[model samples]
Target: MGKVVVVGDRYTVSLFKLIGTEGLVLDDPLNLETTLIKLKKREDIDLILVANDLYNPVKEKVESLVIEQKKPLVTVIPTPFSQGQPLDVKGLILRALGFG
Candidate 1:
């Protein structure tokens, strides 16, 4: 079985850590490409949950890799505890349970 990895800010990484998921805190945008490349080489990582804030900066490159390689599926996720449009917890649960 493969693992799920989170690449984002300290807060984003920390949250995943609580659930025992491995993550990387990437503070510099300039190093984003390098970080992605390194993660791509890791065979144990099957899914990458990239924080939306960081993903937005390198959207093109990330999208291309996801579309072309199709390994280690990449997804953009909202920052945990971020202030924005409120999340629909109930709806999310329903969807997860295949009820929505």
Candidate 2:
């Protein structure tokens, strides 16, 4: 089971690396498709960290996956974006699952 999974671009690498250094094993830093595919196969993942900028590029597709999979997804906005506040993507994921 994955303790935490972070999905984002190179810009968020440091932050996620810090997160990984703390003890979590993140998925490979590769194409989003591969990551999503792996995520789909893993039943142990409980949380997803999606960077704001990267999320925008794949928002529709990611949303579709989240809807189909119905898991807990968290959105992490970059410092320069979203006014530097962390919005709990869990809420969005919950809403998508009709549980919010």
- Choose the strongest candidate by lDDT: 1
Question: What is the lDDT of every predicted structure here?
Answer: 0.72, 0.53
Put down candidate 2 lDDT per residue, 1-100, tens digits, no spaces. Answer: 3445666655455555553511223244335545666765666666666555655666666666655655544434452354566755456445534569
The TM-score, computed over Cα atoms with residue i paired to residue i, of candidate 1 is: 0.75
Candidate 1: stretches off by over 4 Å: 81-100
Tell me the TM-score of model 2: 0.54
Position 22, candidate 2: lDDT:
15
How close is every model to the real structure, measured as TM-score?
0.75, 0.54
Root-mean-square deviation of each candidate, in angstroms?
Answer: 4.1, 6.1
The residue ranges of model 2 lying beyond 4 angstroms of the native Cα positions read 21-30, 72-100
